[model samples]
Target: MDVTQVLRMNGGDGDYSYSNNSLLQRKVISMTKPIIEEALTKLYCAMNFPKTLVMADLGCSSGPNTLLVASEIIKSIDKIRLELGHDKPPEIQLYLNDLPNNDFNTIFHSVSTLQKIITNPSCYFCGVPGSFYTRLFLNKSIYFVHSSYSLMWLSQVPEMAISNKRNIYMSKTSPPSVIRAYYEQFQRDFSTFLKCRAEEMVSGGRMVLTLLGRQSDDPCSKECCYIWDLLAETLNDMVVEGLIDEEKLDSFNIPQYTPSHNEINNEVKKDGSFIVDHLEVSEVKWDACTGYNHNLSEKDTQGYNMGKCMRAVAEPLVLNHFGESVVEEVFTRYTNVIKNRMSIEDTKLVNVTVSMTRKG
Candidate 1:
């Protein structure tokens, strides 16, 4: 499966679309707001009062939170400019980037909405469609970059792990070779991302990246990757019931890797282009919202809510591999499996938020 083609949040503003089901993502954006505010404020203060500021939001899935991020940054810059005794806002060339198949139309149509969000309304919105694994802008064009919950995805599944049948990601039962392959892919992809961004960003440019990550040092730690384990088990159940072929399940693996905090710092150090300003680990519960809420409610069971949340992100991949008919059943089983075994405590998905700046 083409990760770039199929890996997108559920489209549109409908009930099941990412915009509707992205409360968890919104919570994450909110959780990182302080860091964003501080970083942008500092960046503005550090720079000369230029007339235009170039900014890009990578992996900006079409959702309500997309423009909200831009608006928040605009507000930060406004306050900073006021403090610096500038009466006018800088012209911001705001770029929202995602995979090509992502619902760019939905985000593109929201430019009018953006005018209302920013204080000065001086930002020019541009939708740049592509993967963040490669460069999207001219050399030294961007002044600030932001990505959240998106960098966990690799550019592709590790080719060497094709023999890793019956597992979509590293599991407790996975062989050492399989584990190394996933780690190495993340290293390569992340290093390339930094190298490209280093060229695209001006000297002293800023980047704030928030992604799913492992809390433990071990890449194979269960806490870091238990969600995929439950997902694989759900597919295994379907295989037993003849709903999906085992070979199909084996062939399909999520092109995602959640690295440890140490690994993230190491990548920045290895890239030698950016200096890490701050790196933090924040734990978010699996059932972060109503659909994935821990307690079973009268309207939606824990399984049902978790199923919907999982569907929002995984539906595209599931549709490509198992067909549309199997999507609902698989997530139903996914939710049931989680409800039956994993408790509330096991649901913490660690988020690593790192703030960095290009070295002069």
Candidate 2:
């Protein structure tokens, strides 16, 4: 299956749409604000505050979080411009980029609201429909780049990853070859990403990228691996119940990999086009967006909300593979699995934030 054609967050403004359920991603964008500020500040100075700042938010799924990143960038640079007492703010030409199937209409329609929120720097918004794994802009055109909760998705699932069998993602039971395939796929995709961005961004261009990541070198660490593990277990349960085919369970694998901080570092070094300026790992609770109470009684609510969050992001891919018939039931059971696990341990996600500059 061509991942570019099928993979996208649930769109529109309904209950399960990414626009409504993306608080987790919004929190991630918020967490990376300081880094964004610092990167843009230096880039603005390095470029002598160009008249027009060209920027792109890669993998910008539709939602409040879509424009939230733009607002952050504008606010960060606008603050610096004001502090320096510059009479004019740069006109910001921002591109919102994602796969072709993303809800670009929602994003375009929301710009009026964004205009009310941003006063200066006259931002022009346009949606670029394509994969970030390939070139999406003119050479040396973009001055700044930002991506959040996106890079962990590989361009495609590694062919050998299906050999992982029963498990949907990297787990303790995955053999060495499956683990190696995932990492190798990540290395290739990340290097290609860096190479593409390097050509598109001008010298001294700055970028801030935040993605789901792992703290431990072990690819199977719970922080990054458990979400998929739980979903796989849920699928296995369904197979036993005769709700889903066992062979179908064996064939499906999430086209994502959460890398260690050092893995990110190694990819940057190997890519050779960007100099890593800052790299850090931070952890947030799985249910960070929901005001979820940990009381035993509140478990069901937490489970329901968690399932909605995951489904909002995963539904399209899941629907494409498993069909709509099982989507609700799948997440319904998956939530119970998560709720049960919550009773035993706290669930958290590890995020890796990297700030970089294009080599002149």
User: What lDDT score belongs to each candidate, Candidate 1 first?
Assistant: 0.85, 0.89
The model with the greatest TM-score is 2
lDDT of 2 by residue, 1-360 (tens): 689999999999997888988777788889889999999989988888788999999999898998899888888889999887887988999999999999999999998899988878388998999999999999999999999998999999887934777888889999899998989999889999999999999999998999899889899888899988989998999999999998888888899999989999898998888899999999888777564546535656666677788988888878988899999899888878877876678888999999999999
Per-prediction TM-score, please? 0.94, 0.96
| Overall local distance difference test of candidate 2 | 0.89
Model 1, residue 325: C-alpha shift (Å): 2.7
Clashes within 3 Å, all models in order: 1, 0
The sequence of per-residue lDDT tens digits that candidate 1 reaches over residues 1-360 is 778888999999875788778767888899999999888887887787778899999999987889878888888888889988999789999999999999989987887888975688678889999989888999998999999999999999887634677788888777788888888999999999999999999998999999999789887787777878888888987888988998888788888899988999999999999999999999876566555345656334544555566778888888898888888788777877776654444566789999999999
